[model samples]
Structure formats: structure tokens, C-alpha cells
Target: MAKKKSTRRPRARPEAADAPPESANVAQDFANLHVWQIQAFRDILLVAAIVALVWAGYALRAVTVPLLVALLLAYLFEPLIARLSQHPRVSRPTAILGLLGTVGVVVVLLIALTLPTMVRQTTQLVTDLRDERVLARLVELQEAATSQVDRLLGVFSKDETTPDGPETPVTGESDEESAPDGPIPGEPEAGTTGPPVPNGPAVMTEEQVRDLIDERIARERARVAEAEEGGAWWFTPGTGRVARGGWQAISRMIGAVVGIGLMTFLIPFYFFFFSLWYHDVLEFFGRLIPESKRPRTLELLQKMDFVVAGFVRGRIVISLIMGLMLAIGWMICGVPSALVVGLVVGIFCAVPYLGVVGIPLAVGLLVLEQLGLPEAERMGWLWVVLWPTVVFVIVQLIEGWVLTPLIAGKATNLDPVTVLVAVLAGGSVLGIYGMLLAIPLAACGKILLTEVVLPKVNAWTRGEARDPLPLN
Candidate 1:
């Protein structure tokens, strides 16, 4: 055997040439790497991957939003679909299709029932904004605010005035400005400087802020009105026929139509197939994990999924209940656009207490109605602003103390501050989509951390070995 050791290594097997490289299991290539090295590498890769995914998501948000919407709709309708599937005559696909058809019909009925009235009331709102009485009320509000500010300023100022007359807010006027011949009582002259009187029309008056807001709003409203007034057009050069606003409007319209078309085409496409293959999708994702960890992965996934689904569905139900409350309250209060405002506010109720921000507009409409009534009728109408404030307070109490606690709070199990901060951060980063998604995403994250992540981390800390990183 020593003699046979003569310079000959064993021949490689034929199958060896066809064998996959160690790199095929990429982790295997690094099998001999130091633990710290491997950890560093993985950490860097993970950060890079997250960055790439975020960039991709931002770039693909056009398709992404529709896809997400479809996913949400699927989630919303899944229970119903499942229930229907259990019936003798129905299968999953049939159930999905049937439910979608029912949704469509309901949507159509809703539009038919509400659109014309909403349009009429909306027009009335616009016209009312310019009404003399409304303008007078607005002026009265402005004066009241100004007077209140004046009083506030007076508390920090020294005033010398006629005993019979009301004390007015002192200004930064030099005595020379008020009385050129002599220094006004308690006021300094141009030549002499006393302690600076903190004054001058209360810089940036509340009324001024209101005026600025009103001006900006008016400009936007005028622009929209102009667009509506001259919206249609026949023909023109270059663009050949175009919208009333010309090429710009035509382009916008075209873009809008394309977006609508894509949304219409994609949502149903996604929902239909997803509804049919949801379990398959789950399996596909599940199989990405190693056989050993699949059980744990699946368990964790189910928990997160349950949390998200409950939060989403519970939130929607809560919104509906809140909307109903507002609708009934508004109808009883005889608020104009009661249905439209209540529903609009209600549907937006998913974002914690964000919905109540719209109450001022509702209040304004109610105030207008109250003022329009005769004197005797107006007497019974609560103070112009108080009715809306009361309504808002009551609705908020119902939402906070009843609907939310019974529904969304239970669904998410997130404290108010956490939910609010998440919503705000999400809104800052991604606008409406972020706001809508924040709480559910947070819920999922909490579950993931507690169920999936922590368990594995604890196992490692306890010196339990891992094979191919558990997730495979």
C-alpha cells in the first residue's frame, strides 16, 4: 500500500463534475467564517436589502397602491367568501365573484341615492359662503376674535383711558403719533425712550390669520369653479380637440382616465386570483422557510395575520358605527349636508380621532341654517357655534368611550399615544396610505417581535445552535 501511494490521487466521480457548487447554498461558502464576521456580513446585507426594497417600493407605488387596495379588499371580503364557499352550490371563486357583484350593486345604489343630493348641498355650501348674512357672521367672528385678542393683550399692557369708555389695547404708537403737540399720558415721545411697550396691533392678529386662510381658500375655490364653468371644449390646433382648460386639462383628464382604467383593471384582477389562490400563496411563502422552522414561522405568521385582520375589520366596523351615530345626530340637529358630512367624516374615522377635524365645516353649515331662520326660530336654535361644539363633544365621547374601546382599541391593543404617533409618522412619510396602514403594520410588527423574533433570539442567547439560519 505504501508503494501504491505512488503519486496517484483517486479519480473524481463523473457525478462530481455535475454536482452543484457549495455556493449554491451560499451560506455554505461561508461555513468556516468567524461568527462575528458572518454576523457583520448578514447585518450589512440586511440593511442593504431593506434600503433597496424601500427604494423599489417608492418607485413602484403606482402599481403598489392598487395592489395594496386589492389586498385590503380581499382581506375585508375573505370571511364572507369563506362562509359562502361552505354552501353546497358555491365554491371559493364563485363566492368571490358573487360578493364582488353584490358590492358593485351596492356601490351603484349608493351613488344613485346620494350623488345628486350631495351635489345640490355642496353647491349650496359654496353659494352660502358668499351670502351676505354668512359674510356678516364671519365679520362678527373676526371682530370677536380681534376683541378677545385685544383683551388678552391688555392683560400684559398698561392702559390709560376715559372711565366712561372701554379700555382698548395699547399700541406701539409713539406719543407724537397720537398727540403731536405733547406726549400722550403714560406714553413715550420720539425723543425719549421708556420701557418698550410690548404692542402694535397684536402682531399677526387672529383675524389676519383667518383672512389669509380665507383668501387662499377663495382662490382655490375660484380656480375650481372656473374649471367647471368652462370644462368642455370642441376643437383646437396642435392638440386637435381639447378640454375647456385646453392642453393642460386634456392631459390631466387623459392621465386621470388612464389611472382609473388601470385601477379598475388591476384591482379585480388581483382580488380574483388572490381570492382563488390565497392558500397557495401562503404555502409558497411558507415553503421559503426550512422544514425545521416552518412550524414556528407559520405559527408566528398566523398570529400577525390575525392581529392585522382583526384590526382592519374592527376599524371598518367602528367607522361605520361612528358614521351612523353622526348621521343620526346631524339629522336630528337639522344640519345641512348632514348625510354627506357625517359619512365623509365617519369613513375617515379609521385614523383615530382625525375625523373630528372636519366638524368645523359641519358646524359652519349648521350655523348658516340657523341664521337663515326667522328670529323666533333662531331663538330656539342653540348659540351659533355651541350646537356643533356639543355635537362634536358627544360624538367624540361615544367614539372614545364606546365605539373605539369596543372595537379598534380591542383590535389593535395599542395604546392611544402609540397609535397616534405611528399615524402621524406614517402620514408624514407616506401621506394617506401611511396613515391608513400604520396601526395594522404596528400590530404586525409587535406580534413579529414577540412571537417570531424574540423566541429565536432567546434560543440563540441560550446557546442553542441554528442550522442554515432557521429561515433558510
Candidate 2:
């Protein structure tokens, strides 16, 4: 009976013909699994990490600035270290130490000489402003010019009788028309005024005019001297007090020293380690990816190196050349502070448009220091206008025709307009530091977008499951 019951087991239920297959079911299950949720969480965590990094950078500028500066120094010197590392007998550490020592010595020497001069010049200028009554004189000159202009305007206004229109001629022997008899001796005859005696020579004699001008100038100078004497209150020791007083100045100096010291100590270390280990670090990271991707990573690194190294090294060479040229030019012109001027010009040349702007300002200031206001007013204008313009034109020519082609070539390849915009944008954001870093950062972004992001986007548009292989 049991056997019969088993044999007569109920017919199995028929599965739905439209049901999804096992593989589809498995995929759907996988989509709902905790593993996928965990992965999503990981992705969110990564994004948050990136955001935190960005926020940290913005929030901690004091810490970030030094690090950024150190990094830049590292980049600048990496190639030298690499070259030294390649030497047969030189150990990497020894080479690094030697390079750092040389750099340090040079920097120390420059600071020792230049800093004292800068401080002395600044202090002297401040003292001169107070003692020479520069502010008062400026105010007096402004007032005198305003007064002279108003007086001239008043005289012109008074001479015009008709307010609304041109002066009408006297047609019927009006009172305005003079009918005086002038036939007496030493007097003009009727209708013989001889064009009003030509106004006693429209031009004054040289000596007369010179004397008048000298008198006016002496008056103006006296006024300026008075004003300057009056404005001497600002420099009075305790007349005006800073909020934190002298302590603030000392604090600022100490802060500057600390900042500079930190940079000095850390920059070489950053440069050395980054130079020695950057390639290996990059290679190690690349190895974490699939073997097929290593070439692409390496290529990106190489391109970045090319852009950064070219900019930094080219700038250094160009700066040196410009400095030498400026020094020679200044010496030829018999300019004082030729070394200082040349150095300033050379340093400013590192900036794009700043060199053009700064050279003139510096020259003008130097000329002012060398010449008094009157002499400066006469000759300083010419020198200031001529030499700076010449220097700028020559520099532009050399940059466009020679240095740019030879050094930068198509490496950075940014358009001039683009570079200017980048500089302005950077200046607006981070000031000088931002301006200094703008080009390299832009280049790096360009490299990243071209090599990393664009290819994936291209593949996705083509419905490809994977990115195309990068060209070496």
C-alpha cells in the first residue's frame, strides 16, 4: 500500500515559463546584497576623505603654505639631485648633503648682505619721510596746483562778458567801444593802435620768464617746506600708538624668523627626500594597479616632470641672463645701485608681467633717491620713461623669439593670454605664492585632464566597457 502511494505521488507544480533564469536571479540578489552596500559606503568614505583634504588645506593655510613652498623647492632641485645621484662615486646622501650645503651657504650669504641693506633702506626711507616733511610737501603742492588752476579759471571767466554766447561787437558806438583821441606825443593816433602794440611781445624775454618761474617755484617750495614741517607729528615717538605697541613689531619679527627658519630647515629635507624617493614612491603606487596600467601611470609622471622641470629650470636660466643684461645695461648707463637694480630686475623677471611693471617702478624710485624733485622732474622722467620701456621691449623680444622657443618650446605651450589670466587668477587667490604656483598647477591640471579623465569619458561615450590603452 505504501509503495502504491509513493508511485501515485501528486504531479509536481509547473514552473512559470516567463520567470527569470537562475543567473538573473543571482545578479538581482547580488544587487541587494550587503557587500554592494559596503562598497557604496567605501566610495562615500573616499569622497569624504577627498573633501576633508580640501577643507583641511583651506583651513590650515599657515601649515599648508610652508609645505607648499617646501614642495616647490623640492621640485626645483630634484633634477640636480637626480644628476648627482647618477655620478659614479657620489653617494645619494652625500650628494644631497653637498647640494643642500651649497644652497644653504648661498642663501645665508645673500640674506646676510641683502637683508641688512633692505632693513637700513626701509628705516632710512621712513625716517626721511618724517624728517623731510614729504607728506606735508605733497599736500602743499596739491593745494597750490588746485589754487593756481582755480585762479586761472577765474581770470578766464571774468574776461568773458557774455555768459550765454560769444561777445557781440559794438555796432552803434556803444560805451564798450572806445572813441578816445590818442594823437598826443608818446600815444597812438586815432585808428593807429597798431594791433594793440602786439601785446608788448607775446613771448617774454628768457631772463624775465626765468625769473618769474623761479619766483613762483620758490613760493611753492616755501609752502611745501611749511607743510612738511607741520606734518612731522606722525613720526613723533609716542604721538601715535599702535594697538599692540612695539611688542607687535617684535612679535611680527619673531613670527617672520620662525616662519623663515622652518622653511629653511624643512625645504632641503623635503627636496632631498622627494628627489631621491619620488620615482620609487610613484613606481610602488603604480605597481598596486594592474600591470597593463603601469605604463600609463609612468607616462603621466614623465609628462608632469617635463612640464615642471622645464618651467623651473627655464625660469632660472632666463632670470640669470636678464640679470646679467640688466647689470651691464645699468653700468653702461652709469646708474647707481646697478647691482641692486639688476638683481631686482632679474628676480622680477621670474614673474610674467611683473617684470615689465616692476622694473620701471624700481628705476623711478632709484632715480628719485638720486635726484631732487626739480632735477628728477626734469631728467628722471626721461630716464624712467626710456630705459624701462627699452628693457621691457627687449625682454619681450627675447622671450618671444629666443628664450621661450629655446626653453619652454611646446612644453608648457600655454598661450600668452591664458598665462596672463592664470597669473591674475592666482594673484587674486593666493597673492604672490598663488601667482608663483599658477602656471605649474595649470599645467598639472592640463596633464591630468588629458591623460586621465578624457580617455574614460571617450570610452564611455563609445559604449566601451573599459578605457582604451594610453599611448606611452
**Cα error, candidate 1, residue 426 (Å):** 2.8
lDDT of 2 by residue, 1-472 (tens): 5554456677656666667899999898888878536778889888999999989998998777666766676667776777987889997788878988897799789889777765665676667567645654555556666998999999988877447876677676665366555444545556564533342436789689869988998997676667669996354445357545777899999999998888767766676776667668667777797788777777887898899789878877887777767766765654545556666777877877767764665565445444434643445446655775576577668876898779767777688887899889999999987888888888888889888888879877888845356565
Task: Score candidate 2 by TM-score against the native.
Answer: 0.65
lDDT of each: 0.78, 0.72
How many clashing residue pairs are found in candidate 2? 0
Off by over 4 Å in 2: 1-13, 17-44, 57-68, 111-120, 140-167, 170-243, 288-290, 320-345, 363-383, 445-472
lDDT (10s digit) by residue, model 1, range 138-183: 6665676799899988865644333557666777686547755755
Worst 10 residues of 2 by lDDT: 192-201
Clashing residue pairs, backbone N/CA/C < 3 A, model 2: none
Steric clash pairs (candidate 1): none
